[model samples]
Target: MPVHNMHERVLSMGSEEAGALLDSLSAGTADRLWPYDNWPPMEFDRPLSAGAKGGHGPVRYTVAAYVPGVWIRFTFTGPRGFHGFHEYAVLPVDEERTVLRHTLSMRVSGLARLSWPLAYRWMHDALLEDSLDLAERPARQARWSPYVRLLRALVTRVH
Candidate 1:
């Protein structure tokens, strides 16, 4: 099955400021975008750039393309059946507004076709929302669904 999953947040900040958030991805304690506190951290063999290899938890990918403070794309390379890429892009809406978007485009085969819609989809959605919340800095935090909570508990037990 083909999957085109996307999540985006319109932030009330300049493009440069929003771009800075993208640049901070996987930057250890300085990372302000990825929701590492509640989820698996995005790690790579080296600093984030083209050819860096890593992914959160069971997922794995390599940085296929990168444009500092603008856009980055990762091509999947693991867990079998995940074939395609996911990317983050910074789109300026205006001088005072910007759109931070994460897109997952892929085709799932074998067990992934089942695991994806059943489990990974829920967890992925929640994680992306959490990431966006970190970027938006909303006064009220985003809440994960009950299914997501249960899934997290189950995965934690296994790991």
Candidate 2:
């Protein structure tokens, strides 16, 4: 595990559902995740392991992560730096209800662990969780905004 990381139990929707949510969260930084953004999230591509479900089904993956200054390996085994390893476990809370457990883990080496505190700045989980319902369900009625063109400047590349 990395000297710094985050791990928390989040009540998820479903494997496929969560996968979609995961994809969307990732898309926010897709250009970065895929190494096409200004400050790309990682050094290389994050490869999804076979038999591990993801956008298609359950699965495991190893993603190279660059956390600001340090770089690390993330996988089911453990993360090696500031990046936290993640997992998706589907739990049957009920017949129609499933909880997607997304766990993030990081390895601690030396002084870094002593000084850095794990912080969840509304990352991966909360951000997606907020718009999850909106995304999962149908879109609301389209309302016209006169400043639609003006707002585009704020999110220059949202399209």
Candidate 3:
């Protein structure tokens, strides 16, 4: 069977930094890249245009979540094999280490999982991992201010 796989990566940066960029994602960003925006804002970032500043390759996606952050969701054809609703919770791996992981099947499973394979190959195996890493690296270092303001605005709007 072509397994519906879950791919995760830990940037050298901690969840704190990752969370910031993760929080920056909004309908604006999703409309530009993937479809849907109800999934929790992820600890990732994707740039709007090819080779844009602080952009990784032709795409840039970032997020900063606080639940204490925002909640967002979506669907897309990309690496990670038709990524479903992914969730993350930050924790210290060591006294000075932290990690964020992607949770698979939080939504859209069963038939969707079985059906995604052929059409979402860009989202599988080696290619999927690298594509996500492309955006993760730069977003780890992405500026915190925009993310800060963005998160605040989102929280205010929701409440």
Candidate 4:
């Protein structure tokens, strides 16, 4: 299966602030950024660091690697067909700003081939964009497309 990727970056307020936001994610305290509040939130079995195991809803993964205030990677372990990882990173843009990036790169197989394109991809995109907005405070509302809204409605209800 080909690797599908979704990458999003936003101008963060500052390196300190962006690093802090990444810290919040590492602590599993950034649930508000997920697209729907009704769904199960992302979490780690232990703190977000190398070797921690966690995931939300049907997706499961282990923390493959991490660098405090810089990057954290989670390697997928579930939904039966996902083969890859997702990560968040903070790149210093300058003294007053940083680029907060979230990326998901995976090789899908079996059911994932269907689910990833038909369902998960759209939701993931919306979720990341919303997360990026939160990373840059005075958060702007995510402009959810009708497709994204529908996916959110269905997934949240089913879960």
Stretches of candidate 3 off by over 4 Å are: 1-4, 27-84, 106-114, 124-131, 138-159
lDDT of 3 by residue, 56-92 (tens): 1222222222352223223332333333434344444
Best by lDDT: 1
Model 3 Cα shift for residue 120 (angstroms): 2.2
Better of 1 and 3 by lDDT: 1
Query: Candidate 4's error at 68, in angstroms?
Result: 0.7
Best by TM-score: 1
Off by more than 4 A, model 4: 26-39
Off by over 4 Å in 1: none
Candidate 3 Cα deviation (angstroms), residue 47:
17
Minimum summed lDDT over a 10-residue window in model 1 is located at: 133-142
Cα-lDDT of candidate 4: 0.77
Local distance difference test values of all predictions, in order:
0.93, 0.34, 0.38, 0.77
Candidate 2 wrong stretches, greater than 4 Å: 1-16, 19-47, 50-73, 76-84, 118-159
